[model samples]
Target: MQELPGVGLVERARAVAPLIAREADEIERSRRLTPSVVAVLIENGLYRALLPQSLGGAEAPIETFMQMLEEIAKADASTAWCLGQCSVCAMIAAWLDPDTAQEIFNVAPGILAWGAIAHEARSVEGGYRVTARWDFASGSRQASWLGAHVRIVEADGTPRKNADGSPEVRTILFPVASATLHDVWQAIGLAGTGTDSYEVADLFIPERFTAFRDVPAALREPGPLYRIGTGATFSLGFAAVSLGVARATLDAAIALARAKHPSLAGTAMRDNQAVQGLIGRTEGDLRAAGAYLYATAHTMWRDLCATGEFSAAHRSAVRLAATWTIHQSAKVVDAAYHMAGATAVFRSQPFERRFRDMHAIAQQIQARDTHYEDVGKAILAGG
Candidate 1:
């Protein structure tokens, strides 16, 4: 099938869902995506969804990207999480020089992943020298390149500051071979993501390989998608992933309710009024949360495309919607898991894995309760 920018990506994702579902167990067992799953994702151009078109990417609309992730997530949350992490990382190409961007991301399987901001780079002639370790690099196992977000410090250890007097942070890019990978990703869920730690000791990165991420003045690409920024894109994509997980879990519960009968009770679960009521309420909650997330993303995307601007209000709206959707999705999964009773605790059932994945997603930084506080402060301050 021919793929066009921002077109039919959701269908492509759905087409691949069954394969992803089949590989889900192997993925968790290996703590990384299977080669088959990775090939399908790359072959379908899913990883390039957020990359600029100039770099041979889809440059898809944000809503389209979210929908695509939602579909993949219904099959496997880990696959969706890895895809979301790497796809958002591709936005850095927009802030980089054309030659540099092409050199880094134009190659086959051009995937990059990074961890949380940590440590600092000491300034040197023509580049900066970094000797720092970063953690939580989801999808790093499959990435050809890895990046580090660090504050810049001068030779004598003085900090480099922007004109506004804030300390400067830049994302430094390097080949994955330059870093020492650590196998420390043991977790309660989302094990397939390979969200591990990596370290680079006294490594030198050329100035050309660094980017001032999320800073408008440093952007080299003029696409509206980049205006949404990586952080916000991640929030939007992961929210959709949560929705997918919740949807699947609830569906599994409904199926169980229809077929399952209590040992002592005379009626099937579907005949229980309490089970019927819970299913109705949970389905409504899931659908409503998904609608709110998609509507908020579409509104921001429309205004951005027309005006070439992404307002602070737009960012706040996305943050609120994404965080709330994740929390609500978790609640849906919890209800569904409980509704499944003893079956949910067994590894053989669908509810067990999704229940764990939903909680893990909720525990992530994107789903933090502090986002609500941030949005509240922004509203009260009239932002």
Candidate 2:
């Protein structure tokens, strides 16, 4: 197992940010990360941050993962988005059998990407059979393996139930070659992710290749990092990515203000009291959002490490912090974009791409307003 070559994960991500930044336009134009960018990511071990150390992965703390994504997003949000998607997907290895996990993640360019739950897997002899299509697979373009989350049913088509009476859902993994990919990721922003849809008809997955992901009872690894659910980890990572985009956009605005003189204005934009105040206020907002997110993640991580358990309160706090940070980051980006005036609308300017990418991040399921409602309900219930 080759070790990550750098001072740390966050530093490594920051060091590679410029390389990805140079490739940003090409990445967006091609609607996928350039081969060079992908190679850099793999070589740096950024894709293996969340995998178990037992498998030669960094297995860094959630806070480290969040910070890493933020740094990457400072250069390119699409790259950050893809990295976060695939990194969190690696958590499935904790629930898989040791040999199976080794086979899937311990190989060269070991990358796994999966989509949302969209179908059912029928229980059969020794395993299950599934014929379903899943969408929004963000990093499929670079994944060697693909996965689908589906509810399980018996051979007679009867839905399998957990101890709590809810339907059982299993994530079935298979080589990417076994599925058919569709080119359907065209969008206003984050176009480089290649978040296409995929389908597999009448495919049989062996029992060894399926796992009860995100379920506490099924974890085969005893690491504190895997204690937090995959969904929450994703929320944290993407929220950090949002902050990075917002930070870069605001910095660009600040740079423009320092150099540009408005038409007919007596002085540079930076000399304007209004622009100074806006910059100050937006900076404070962005800082506060980032602080809150990191604080929440740190507190939860400490508690989980000490107690070896994750509570409902921890989940609610993380969801609230992640959602609020994403929304606040969008506001910062919007303010910065408007403050840049005519320069922001031009394709050549840095502001436009980050603006589009920030909005696209907000539009993702993790940023939905319903998350706030869920947090509110949890608080009201004294959870």
Q: Which candidate is the best by TM-score?
A: 1
TM-score of 2: 0.98
Deviation in Å, model 2, residue 383 alpha carbon: 2.4
Worst lDDT run of 10 residues, candidate 1, spans 1-10
Clashing residue pairs in candidate 1 (N, C-alpha, C atoms within 3 angstroms): none
lDDT of 1 by residue, 1-383 (tens): 77568787899999999999999999999999999999999998999999999888989999999999999999999999999999999999999998988888988679999999999999999999999899999999999999989999999999999999999999999999999999999988898999999999989999999999999888888899998899999999999999999999999999999999988888999999999999999999999999999999999999999999999999999999999999999999999999999889999999989988999999999999999999999989988
lDDT, candidate 2, 229-277, per-residue tens = 7999999999999999999999999999999999988989999999999
C-alpha RMSD values across all candidates: 1.1, 1.6
RMSD of 1: 1.1
lDDT of each: 0.95, 0.93
What lDDT score is found at residue 245 in candidate 2? Answer: 99
TM values, all candidates: 0.98, 0.98
